[model samples]
Target: MERIYLDNNATTIVDPVVKEAMDPFYCQMYGNPNSLHSFGTEVHPYMKIALDRLYSGINARDEDDILITSCATESNNTVIKGIYYSLIRTGRKSQVITTQVEHPCVANSCRFLESLGTDVVYLPVNEDGIVTPEILREYINPDKTALVSIMWANNETGLIFPIKELCKVTHENGALFHTDAVQAIGKIPVNVQETGVDFLSFSGHKFHARKGVGGLYVRKGTDLPTFMHGGEQMASRRAGTIDVPGFIGMGLAMELAVRNLEYEATEVRRLRDKLEDAILSLKDVLVVGRREIRTPNTILASIRGVEGEALIWDLNRSGVAASTGSACASESLESNPTFVAMCISDELAHTGIRLSLSRFTTEEEIDRSILVIRQSIERLRNISSR
Candidate 1:
């Protein structure tokens, strides 16, 4: 049977062009960028060129703002921990504000800070999965508000948050605002200057890059505490010898994603909508992220009478790949709290499945997926009726 991949949100297959671009980095120029020796320095120029690729793609202002790290998880941890510590040491602020819909990385990071006696507040999001600016402004306590970390785009439901507006609110309250754009970077247009975020985190695999590389876009002169403890790398913000090949892969993947962003997003949105339209037409099925402001490439639906894991397995058997929620908690047999925060019914939350598309996804694959889901739901219904 032919296979169909609808799980772009979890990860995408490494694009061949991205792979081809990485060939020489590992095989030929296999040298640590930190070394001053001729062999090592040889890759320095390539790394610089790659930095140009990444920075230009994201429209970052100063080259100093981009700091490479292991993944978005590390990027997030660095930013959250760094800022929290920075504020505490300077007696600036003591409270952290975020939303319930954040990726587990951000959520857990906040929890960690709370463990350290730092105050943390989880502002609620609307039913459409949006954490509105007004709620943030209402909760803002500048005297104790250290930072506000919100996700620009939710990974599970694909709803795009209003980062720019929220940033304006947070700034008015005298709190630094940050956004985790791991899912938003390549799919939507991201401009650091335009968005006015103090820190932004992005992962390579979220776009077309390899798994091990990601970056934190820190606005110039945004003081923070240390994350990595080692010799010079990422200007000591994230210490350790950089993975030259991984960064190179990240650079190329970003180049492709940004260069073709408009064309890719438009096409993927068309395919995503077709799949969503077909699935929601079935009895007792609801598309969770049906709100107008949701992400273009994300289609979330709930099919009653079936567990999410069971649905995922059944779809897997039929050669259709999708997801229940965040990859960080994929193996857990728990319902997505993000959907729960969106006020989805208990029955539907357990049944939620997310189908994310990519630029390379085709109409035929989407149509095939629609058929597979219908069959799987029917089989599940028969089981339930018995």
Candidate 2:
């Protein structure tokens, strides 16, 4: 049986081209970038080239602005905790602001900070999972605000936030801004210079690269305490021996994504709408984030009278793969915080199923997925009614 994987938001299959680009590094080009030998020196250029590619992909001002890390979790922790520690030492600012719909890494980071007596504010989002600039402006206090961390795009609903405007508001209020762009990067254009974000975090696996590689963009002159302590890797901003092969794969994957961005936006979005429309035609199903500005490849639909996990299991048996919410929070039985924050009823939240696509997702798979979901929902609802 052929499987139709629709969980791109959780992670993506590594592109063949990216894998090819990384193959040599695993055996022939394996060398620690920090080493001074020929083996290391020869491998060093690849890392630099990867950094340059990432810089170009995001339109970052300088290559030095990028700090390589293991994943977006580390990047988020580094930015939020680093800023808090750095500012507390100087007795300048004490507040951090973020949204309730942010990924667990970011949301939990704020919670941890709050426990430590940091004034952390989790701004609420609209029903469409959006945090408007107006809402941000209201919470921002220049005198006490040190940083504002928000996500560029939501992983579940695929809703795109106004990062550029939010960054401007934060700066005007005398605070720095950070955006977790893990789901936004590659799928959309991200120009750090244009957005003026002080810090940005993104993971490679979200965009067809290896899982162990990720990057953080920090504006020049933005002072923050280092998250890791070790050798002079990532300009000493992050300390650890870099994953050479993973970085190579990420660079190639990002290069491909930028080159095909337009096609992904148009074609993928068309396919997503087709799937959504078909699914919505079924009775008693509501599309989450339907009216919001969303990314090209996600659809979160709540199927009434059916449990999300059970429906997903049925879909899996039918060769269709989907999700209930963030893979990071999949182990929990509670409703997703994103839906809860939107004030969605417990019944709807528990029935919400997320279907995310990728450039490789074909129209045939989408059609099959729609059919499978409709059948699964019908079967589950019938069973529930009985």
Candidate 3:
């Protein structure tokens, strides 16, 4: 049986071109970027080139605005805690605002900050899993707000948030804005300059680059405290010896993504809509946030009376790979908080399954996946009824 992987939101397979771009850095150019030796000097220019590519990929104003990190988790932690700590010293703003549907990293970071006696507000989303600018204005106050961290696109429901407008609101209140764009970076156009976000976090593996590498876009002049403490790497913003091969792969991946973004958006959206239509044709099934503005490659559907884990297992046996929710929170038995925040019933939330596509996802895979999902949901429903 052929395997159909539809878990792009969890992670993506590394592109062969990106792998090839990383080959030289692994063995031939194995020199510490901070070293002064000629071998190291040769490696430095490649890092510069990678930074330049990333800058172009996001339309960043300057290369220095980007800080290389291990993953979006670290970046999220840095932004939330960094801003909180910086402001705590000056006794200025003490409130941090974020949506209820944030990823585990950002959500937990806020929880942790709250434990430290900081005011953290988790704004609720609408039934469509969105936080409108009007709702944001209610919580934002220039006198006491420090940071507003929201995600650009949700990983589970694929709902796209109004980051550009939200950032403007944040700035008007004299607060910095951060967006976890891990799922949105390659799937949508992300121009940092246009958005005016003070900080943005994105991971490599989400965009066909190698895992264990990601970036934090810190707007120039943002007073963000450093997260890591070691050698003066990442212009003293982040510390540690950089992963040369990973950065090279990420740069190549970003370059490829920017070049193929239009094609990717069209193709993935077509396949996703096809899958959604087929799944919705089945009885007693509902697509989460279907009418909302979402990413091009995600479909979160709920099949009544069927458990998501059971459906996923059945699909896996049939050579179809999918997910229940965010990969980071999959280990937990609890239902997806995003659905709960939307006030979806427990039965529907428990049955939610997410299928996220990629540029490499083929139409045939989507067709097969739809068939497999229909069969799995039917079989599971039959079993539950019995």
Candidate 4:
């Protein structure tokens, strides 16, 4: 049986072009980007070219606006905690605002800040998991609002947030805007210049790059609170020498991912829609969220009366790999709060399975997946009836 992968939303496979691009950096072009020697300076140009490619991918014109980290999680932590500390030192941080449906990285960071004397407000999302600017206005105070951290896309349902309009609201109130773009970067365009977001977080692995590389985009003129203080690297924002290969691979992945975004997005959306249509037509299967407004490569469906974990196991036995929620917290026994926050009924939430397609996911896989899903649901339902 051919194994079908449908969890691209969790992470994607590295592109061949990205690997080819980073080959020289690993063996021949190996040099510290921070070194002042000739060997190091020679590789700096390639690194600069790489950074420029990433800027174009994100539509960020200023290269200085980007700060490379290990992954989007670090980016989120650096930005949320970094900006919060900066505000506190300036006597501006009394509270921070974020949505309840955010990834654990942002949600937990806010909670950590709250634990240390700062107030954190978790705004609620609508039925479709949309956070309106009205909710921002209702909760924000001009005198003490320091920063607002929100996600660009929901990992479960692929519901995109209005970063552009919402960021405007936060900025107008004198609060810095930060967005976790981990799921939005390669799947969609994320131009900080256009969105007016002060800080943006993204992981290279999410976009076909290496696992240990990601970045936080801090807009020019924004002061970042220091995270690491030992090494002189990263202009003192974060310490230690950069991962040369990871950085090169990340930039390569971003460049190549953008080249195919337009074509892949159209095709992925077609395949994803077909998958959703096929599954939802089955008896008692409910397609979650707005049918057409979701991500191009993701489909989250609820099989009425079956459990998600059980369904995943059966599908795996049948040669399909899937996920229940964010890969970061998948091992935890806690229920997925994203579905709960959306108010999906306990029975439905228990059975909700996330099938995220990718540029590499073929049409045949989708067809085979539909059959497997139908069989699994039927079997599980029958077992329960017995």
Candidate 5:
């Protein structure tokens, strides 16, 4: 049986070009960038090229601090906890704001802060699965709220938030803004200067770069306390030797993603719509958000009377890779959190499944997968009915 991959949102296969670019660093120029010896110094030029790619990919300025970290989880922890240590712990502020639909790292970090007496407000999303500026204003305590962390694109639903407008609101309220751009970076154009976000977190694996490498963008002169200790690496904002090979590949991947963003918006989106149309044509199935509001390559659909896990298993057996939701919590046996946040019906919430595509997802794969998906769903629905 031929296999088709439709789980790019959970993680993407590394691009072969990126792999080829990273291969030489392992044995050829294997050296710590911090070392002054020839081996280490030999990699500096390549490192500079990688850094330049990263900065240009996101439109970050020269003065901004792009600290390389282990993953988006670490980058997120650094931002949330850094704010606590920098402002909240200092007694200058006591509250933070985030949406109820944030990724686990951001959501759990806020919960941790709340345990320490910090007032954390989780703003609710509307039925459209979005936190409107009006809702933000209703809950924003301007005098006390120090930071507002929102994701640029939701991991489960792939809904794109109005980061530029939200950042403006947060700034007007005198609070710093942060966005988890893990899902948005490669699929959409991200300009930190235009959005005016104080901090942004991104992961490599989401965009065809190898896993275990990510970065945090800190605007110039932002006072974020160090999240790690014991080393002066990453300008002392983060400690530990960098993953040179991972970063190199990630930098190239980012550049490629940005360069081919138009293709993603066009071809990838067309295939996504074709897949969604097939799913929606079935009885009692609906997509989470309108296509206009979501990233180009994602589809979150709910099939009534069918269990999400059962559908996923059925699809897997048919040689199609799909997801019930975020891979971070895939094994938890829980309902779709995005549906829950959108106030979807309990019966339908448990039936949600996500199918995400990537630049490499070809038309032929989508065509073949559509037939398999339809067969899987029909079979599952029949069994559930019986």
Candidate 6:
């Protein structure tokens, strides 16, 4: 059986080009970027090139700070906690605002902040799983809100949020705006300057870069407090030695991913739509979120009378990789939270399964995946009805 991996949103296979770019950094050019020795300093030019690629990929300003971290989780934690220490702790503000459909990293950070006595408001998303600027205005108070964090694209339903409009609202209220763009960077055009966002977080693995590498984009003059404390690395903004290989790979990955955004929008979307249309042809199946508003590579569908985990297992047995929802929440064996947040019924909520694609996804794989999914659903439903 040919294995069809449709879980790109969870993580992607590192592009061969990116891997090749990073190979030399492992043992050949191994050096601490912060070291003054020749071995270390010699890597500077390559590092600079990588940094430039990263900046150009995001359209970030020269004066802005891009702090490399372990992954999007670290980047998220840094922005949330940094805001807590810098603004809320210092009496500048007392509350943080975020949507209910956020990934566990952002959601849990808010939950943690709540325990620390910071007012954390999880704004509800509409039936489409979107937190519009109007919804934000209802909860964000200029006097109390220190920061508002929202993800640019939902991992479960692939719903794209209105980042620019939401950021404008947050800024108008004198609060900083941050977005977890982990799912959005490669899938969409993410120009930080155009969004006027104060901070952004992204993971390299989500975009065909190696794991263990991600970054935080802090706008100039943001005054974010330090999240890590140790070496003078990252200009003392973020501590610890840099992952030179990971950085090189991720930078090139970002550049390449952005370069193929057109293909992502056209070819990827066509394949996704083909798969989605086939899934919808099945009885009692509905895709979450409007296809027009979602990222081109994702489909979260609810198949009535079929349990999500059962469907996932059946798909796996057929050599097709899929998920029930966010990979981070998969072990919990619970219903899809994003479905619940969108006010989907308990029955359909538990039936939600997500099939995400990537730039590398092929039309043949989509066709095969659709067949496997249809067979799996039919078998699962037959068993349950028996």
Instruction: Report each candidate's C-alpha RMSD, comma-separated, in the order given.
Output: 1.9, 1.8, 1.8, 2.0, 1.7, 1.6
Task: Provide the overall lDDT of each model, using Cα atoms, as 2-decimal numbers.
Answer: 0.84, 0.87, 0.88, 0.83, 0.90, 0.91
Candidate with top lDDT is: 6
Between candidates 1 and 6, the TM-score winner: 6
lDDT of 3 by residue, 95-170 (tens): 9999999999999999999988889889999767899888899999898889999999999888999899999989
List, residue by residue over 41-87, the lDDT tens digit for candidate 4: 88888788878888888878674468778888888888888866788
- The clash count for each model shown is 0, 0, 0, 0, 0, 0
Shift in Å, residue 384, candidate 5: 1.6
Off by over 4 Å in 2: 326-330
Please, what are the lDDT tens digits per residue for candidate 2 over residues 1-386? 99999999999999988998999898998888788898889987787788779999998886338888899999999998898789844679889999988999999988988888889899999766799999999989989999999999998888899999999999999899999999998788888989999999999999999999899989888987889999898778899999999988898888888987898789998999899999889888888775348888989888888878888889999998888853223666556888788766666677888899999999899988888887888899889992
Off by over 4 Å in 3: 326-331
Model 5 residue 105 distance off true place after TM-score fit, in angstroms:
0.7
What TM-score does model 5 achieve against the real structure? Answer: 0.97
Question: Against the hidden reference, what TM-scores do the models get?
Answer: 0.96, 0.96, 0.96, 0.95, 0.97, 0.98
Give model 3's TM-score versus the native structure: 0.96
Q: Model 1: per-residue lDDT, tens digit, 318-356?
A: 999988753233566555678778877766667788898
Candidate 6 runs further than 4 Å off: 326-330
lDDT of each residue in 1-386, candidate 6, tens digit only:
88999999999999999999999998889988888998899889998988999999999999998998999999999999999999998998999999888888999999999999999998999877799999999999999999999999999888999999999999999999999999998999999999999999999999999999999999999989888999898989999999999998999999999999999999999999999999998878888889888999999998988888888988999999998853323667555557768877666667888899998888889888888898988898999882
Q: For residues 1-386, could you state the per-residue lDDT of candidate 5 as single tens digits?
A: 77899999989999999999999999999999899999899988988888999999999999998988889999999999999999999999999999989989999999999999999999999878888888888888778999999999998889999999999899999999999999998898999999999999999999999999999999998889998996888878799998999999999999999998999899899999998998888888888898999999999888887778788888898899988852223567555556678876666567778899999999999999989888887888788892
